[model samples]
Each structure stands twice: as C-alpha cells, then as structure tokens.
Target: MKYKYILFDADDTLLDFGKAEWFALNKTLEDIKFNCNKYIAEKFSSICDKLWHEFKLDEPLNRYVQINYHDLYYKYSVERFKDLKELLDINISAQLLSEKYLNSFSECGFLVKGAENVCKQLSLQYKIFVVTNGLSHVQKSRIGNSKIKSYITDILISEDAGCAKPGKEFFDYSIKSLGTSNLSEMLIVGDSIITDIFGGNEYGIDTCLFNSKRKINKLKIQPKFEIRELNELLGILRI
Candidate 1:
C-alpha cells in the first residue's frame, strides 16, 4: 500500500549529524581555548547522550523539568568535562560554551548524500514532516539554513512537541497535529532502531530502517523496510 505521509528523523537519517557534531565541537573547543582532542569529543558526546537519555525518560517533556532544559543540559556538560572548566576562566559560564556549540551547529548545514533529492521527490506525492528529537532552536536553525526545509511541510522537535520519540505521546501529537488517526497511511523512517523503528512499531505505523552503516539490529522489533541510502527511499515508495 502507498503511504500518504512520510515521517522522518532528521539527524543521521537525512542530516550528517556526526560531521555537524564534530565541526561544532571543534569550534566550541577553539572558541573556549580548550585543547581539541578525541577524548574531549567522546566525553562531550557521552555526557550529552547520557543527559538526553535521562531527559527522554520523563514524558510530556515540560512536566519533567524544573529548570530551563538547555541550562540543565549545559550544566551537566560543563560539570562532566572538568578539564574544560579548569581551562575556562572563572567568569565564563558553561552556558556560554553550550551556546558556542549550538551556534556552530547552526552554522554548519551538512546533509546526507541525496537527502534533498529524496525528500523533494517524496514531497511531491506524500506529505513529509520532520519528526526529530533535539533542541528546538538548534534543529530549527539547521533546517532553516538547509535546503531540506523546503521539502518538509513541518518540523516537530521533541522540545517543542512536548514529548520525545519511542513515547506514545510523541506519535499521538504528530497524528493529532496532522488531523489524522489512520496510522496505516504513514511511514516512519529513521536510522535509529530503538527510537525510530521501535517507536513506529509501538505507534502502529510502517517503519523503514535507514541503516546507513548496515549495523545489526539486536532489538526484537523489525522494520517493514530497510534501506542503505536516502535515494533508496524512492525505490521503497515505488516512484
């Protein structure tokens, strides 16, 4: 059956997030006069991932927090990276470092190969929405600066959507936002098996696993289709 709407995960699925992250991290390090090293990058990524994991555990995103989400996220990053703190002056706040990283990320508009081609092609026949989970400002800036935004009808970042993926509330919001309850008419495509595939399965929508790395899926959940590249999506849609 043909899918009427396509829900896409923005990061690795369509955008080159790894490259963006690396660029942003390097810029942040340089801006803050911290020595750039692999260890630092890994540590930053690890801390951010851990904080995001914790953040996702709480549903209805807003109800789970007391402080500003960005402040909390940067607070953890600064505290975890003691080296950076030692290097930074006493007056510099962790929030400033976080701001540097995000601004750098916003400046870099890296997209996966054939991302625009696929999205533009799919947008002609199917309503395409970016169902991403990340900072609203950063994600919006990246999309706004990139050509991919032209192919999307709307974007739903978890920060603004009030829920994170793999949670039923997220999908419910998307469905309700689009005024559709027919889950069968939509397809959820993303690189993450745990969030994208599992979320789609749990939400009763068809899942397309964009396994760019061709990694093994240890999860019990199975996607309806798997593609190695963005261009392959066209074939899946039989365009």
Candidate 2:
C-alpha cells in the first residue's frame, strides 16, 4: 500500500448512523408526547442532512452552531405534525429537543457490518484516524462505546477541530495534529461525496467513497476509488 495514514469517516461509513439518528429522534419525540412514524423520520432525516451539508461547508467556532442547527432540524420535524401546534408550541425549544436526541443517540452502538474487523486489521499496517463532523461530546460517547475504539489511533470531530469536512481548514488542522505534511501519504474513506470525496480531493489526498447503498455519483467530483463494502478496502491496499 502507498498510504501511511487512513482517515475514516465515523458515521454511515463505519457506524450505522441512520439507525442511531432514527432511534434518538423518535425517542426524543416520544418523551414530549409526540407520536412519530416513518414519515416523520424521513422528514427529520432530510432536514438534518441539509443542515449537515451546510455545516461541512463553513467553519464555526461557537459550539452553539451545532445546537442551533439541530434545533432548526427539530423545528422542521415538528412542522410535520399538523395538529401538534398546540402541544409543540413556541415554548418547545429546539435546543431541548437536540439535547434529548444527543442523550439518546450517545447510547446507541450500531456499527456497520465488518467495521471492527476492518479497523482491527488495518491498524496493524496503517495509522487509522476517525474524522467526523458532529458534536464533540456525542461523537466521543459513541466512538468510546464502539468496538473499534481501541483500534482507532485518534478521533477528530469537527466541533473540536474548529471546522468541518470539505473545508481545507479541517484537513489542514488534522494534518498538523497528526504531525504530517505529506498529503500524498494520506487516504480518506468516507460515505459523503460532498464531505469525504470533496474534502480529500480539495486537500490533495487519495479518497475512497464507501457507497454501501451503491448510490450513483451524480456529483461532478469523483473519488480516486469507490467500494461497496468496508472490507473491500483491504483489497485496495493490496495493490
């Protein structure tokens, strides 16, 4: 393998984030006496997806951005309930809903299939770093509880990094933290075309898109490599 450092995305790439998000959101809504269904889940996910996409584009030092972003997502989620205006009125803060969701999400430990095995095996030959964009506390809790925690050399969250993915600042900070300036020796593997692929591509590093769902690449940018399975990365390293 040519790469000395491997930066792994922690969400859908390694952890089953969709499940965690769904569980946390529904659980939070349940606490507030709201009945949630698949329709609400889908709407919440869509709203969150947009927020995260925007987050990945800019650097915000205030951690309040994370809270406020989630609040906005929750507000949109509440909008789906037509008659719930009376129950989920102005008094209901997005911050409250976000805090509830984070609390519930932190307890989730759903890993993608073969994530631990792949990480364990890769750690032997290459330095593995988890690069993620989310609340530091929430990301830390989930990563700490995951089976692959021991295998990761470090966990870099956007909250602590002062920036998110697709932005060169985050990657630059990561490079400095790792004490390496050789971008050519680093490889980034992630699920997001906008974040993982675009970030690595912009930062001058090799990138591998982990399209577990086999989604087509509609974006103009393309990754150096693409894999449908986590373990398939091992084969990429062999050559």
Candidate 3:
C-alpha cells in the first residue's frame, strides 16, 4: 500500500516462457535433423533449470552456460559426430537456436491473465519496472514487442547491468535506475522464490510470489505475499 515502484519478473511471471521455449526448441531440433521428442525436451528443461540454479548460487555466467551445454551434449552423446565446439558452432547452431527461441518467444507475447490490465491500472499510480536475469538484447526484444511495454517505466536486464537476479548488485542497480531511495516503497512480483522473491527481500522491498502453479513446497524463505493470479495484486496494492 505504501510502495511507489512496482518491479516485475519477465519470464514465467509475465510471459508464457514454457510455451515459447517448447516451440522454439522443438523447431530448432527439427531443423537440425534431430528428434525433438517430449523426453528430450523435458531433459533439456531439467538441465537448464539446474544450470540456472547453479548460477543463482554464484556460478560465473560464462562457466554456467558452457557447463550446461557441455553436460547436455555429453548426456545425449551428441559428440559422436564432432566435438562440443563443432556441435555448438555458434554461427550455425547456437545462434540459430537462440534466434529461433527469441522469434517464437517474441511472437507469442502472452501475458498472464490480467497482467496487462494490472499494469495499465497501476501505471496511473506507481512507476513500473522490470527486473530480469537475461541477456539485454533478448529481454529488450521481448519487452519492446510485448503489449505491456507501453506501461512499463523501465527495464533492467542482467546482461546490461552486469549482474543477475538474487544478487544484491542487480537489485541495487534496479533501485538506482528507478531513482528510488526508499526500499520499502517498492514491491517485486515474480514467480521464482530463489530469484525474484529472495532478491527483492534482500533489498528490503516487499515481494509477492506469483505461485500460479501452486507447486512451491515447504520453504524457509517466505515471501511477503503470494498469489495465484495477476489480478490478485489489486487486493494487495489496494488499487
């Protein structure tokens, strides 16, 4: 009720990340003459999630990406034809996969239910910002192409800020960029407890965990609030 700034998470919280990732990866695998089966896709998701969790635990970005891909390749025995470098050949494979993912991701632009409307309504009273752990170009592309872009006051991506979420530095950068000195006058809304909620809590900002899936197990780190729908924010904000 006292917040003047509202920060949001980009991936699953705002955008339908799972849908986009599935479409892109499936298409990319098919294009590369690989079987894009559900099992493979699920495996890839698990691998990516683990890598991200490691990143949250303070692994360097470069090492995180490299190790993740390397492990995936190893697990799939993808080096039968060539080495990891040859298999990943950025220009041919990595870049293509990234582009495909971004394209599919940008094309969908599906916001959680009431997200756009909430942004529009909240924009009248609060300055809205997006704090995400992602490449700047990719995050910017998604934001610029999304319906909520017009309502957002600013966006802070990890690549541009040289830090990722759950890190105090990234939250500091976001606070500075928002030109707000009172941490209590800010709220962070996101789906990830380890990233969004924990990061915001570290910065002394109120956090609302968007647990839409209702999958969060018993955890020690409790968010200030939890909601299953974006519209539920109205109740918390008293809008």
Candidate 4:
C-alpha cells in the first residue's frame, strides 16, 4: 500500500515475448527464403540471445543494429561471402529479417495470463507505466495492440528516451515522466534481475521480480518481492 506508482517491463513480464519472438523469427526466416529448419531457427535464436546480452552489458547506442547482424552472420556461417558489398547486402537482408520479426511481433497480442486483470485492478489504485528497452515504434505498436493499453498511463521506450534499462538515466527519465520526486512511492516490476531489479534498486525504488518461469538464481541484488503469477500482485498491493 506504500507504492502509488507501478512501472512494468513490457516484454516477458506482461507480453508473452518468447512465443511471439519464435513466431516472428520463424516468419522472418520463411519470408527470406531461408531454410527455417527447426535446428537452424533455434541456432539463430541462440545467436540473437547472446547479442542481446552483450548489448545489455555494453549499452552502446550506435551499434544496436550492427551487433545483431554481425552475430547473425557469424552464427549462420555467412562470412564466406567475402566481398564487402556482399557482406553489406547480407547485413541488409538480415536487418530486413529482424525488422519483419519486430513488425510481426508487435502484431502478436499475446499477453501472459492475469496480466490484463491485474493491470486493470492496479489501475484503479496506482499510476501505471511501461518501461521497456525496445524501439519506440515497435513498443508503441505492441502496447496499442494490447488490451491493457487503456490501463497504462505512459509507455517509455529506450529508443525515444535515449536510454536503456539498468542505466540510472533511464530510471531517472521514468521518474521525471511520472511527475514525482519521491522514489519510495514507486515500484518496478520486471523479469530481468540485471535490468529491472537492479535499475529499480539503484534508483531507490521498491521492486518485484516477476519470475513466472522460476528461473532466477539467488542474486546479490534482492528484489523487495517476487511473484510467479501476475495475479499475486493484486494481493501484494492489497488491491
């Protein structure tokens, strides 16, 4: 009952991002006339996961697209195309592939069970916002397609804000946007310990780890609360 603002992570916390990502990536592979054999698709996904992990750590703004494509090419063994122009062409193709994935991903309106109900319930008592580390256009489209859009007060994407999660600047931007100076009255709910939990802790806000998959380890950075289901949040908030 102490928190008046609830900031949520968009991807896995509310959206069923893993399923959406799989569908989008498979669609992209098919569109590019690539053999999307199950094995190949899984391998490409692994490559993407690694690149995203690195991006999260390095926080390089300019190399976002380049790093993804570089990892894709290396993972798919496309480096044999030695001509610089050929490599560039391949990069363009990969970019298009990823763009399609993002586009399709935005259209997929898959939400985790209880996400809508919980958001709606919380909306009555708290100011709710989405804080996500994704491209502005894509994140906007996804929220627009979701049922919880009406319940959320604001959507903050890293691209438009010029900062990503786990950065103090990103949390500061979110706090500023909420029109509040008190950090104790805000709570951040997210799935990633490295980003959302850590970022919220750094910003001196309470945090809830949405560990739906029960995969998080006992980390040094402790979240104020943990819930395996979104519905549990209503009880935590005494809604």
* Candidate number achieving the greatest TM-score relative to the actual structure: 1
Residue 63 CA displacement from its true place in model 3, Å? 12
Per-model root-mean-square deviation over C-alphas: 3.7, 4.7, 5.5, 5.4
lDDT of 3: 0.72
Question: Global lDDT of each model?
Answer: 0.78, 0.77, 0.72, 0.75
Model 1 score (lDDT): 0.78
Candidate 4 residue lDDT tens string, 1-239: 88999999999998888778777766765666654566755666566556545444334334443234334333332222222114234444544455566678778767889999999999999999999877677778888888999999999876656666776667777888999999889999999987789778877889999999888577688999999999999999998
For model 4, where is the 10-residue window of minimal lDDT?
76-85
Kindly give the number of clashing pairs for every candidate.
Answer: 0, 0, 0, 0
Model 3 backbone overlap count: 0
Mind giving the per-residue lDDT tens digits that candidate 1 earns over 1-239? 46899999999988899999899889877876766788877867776676556654333225344224444555555554444555434346666776777789887668999898998899889999888877788888888888888888888876676656766667877888777888889999999887789888987899999999989988688999999988988987888
Give each model a TM-score. 0.83, 0.80, 0.76, 0.81
Write candidate 2's Cα lDDT for 178-214 as tens digits. Answer: 8889888999999988778987888889999999999
Better of 1 and 2 by TM-score: 1
Arranged by lDDT with the best first, the candidates are 1, 2, 4, 3
User: How much does candidate 1 score in TM-score?
Assistant: 0.83
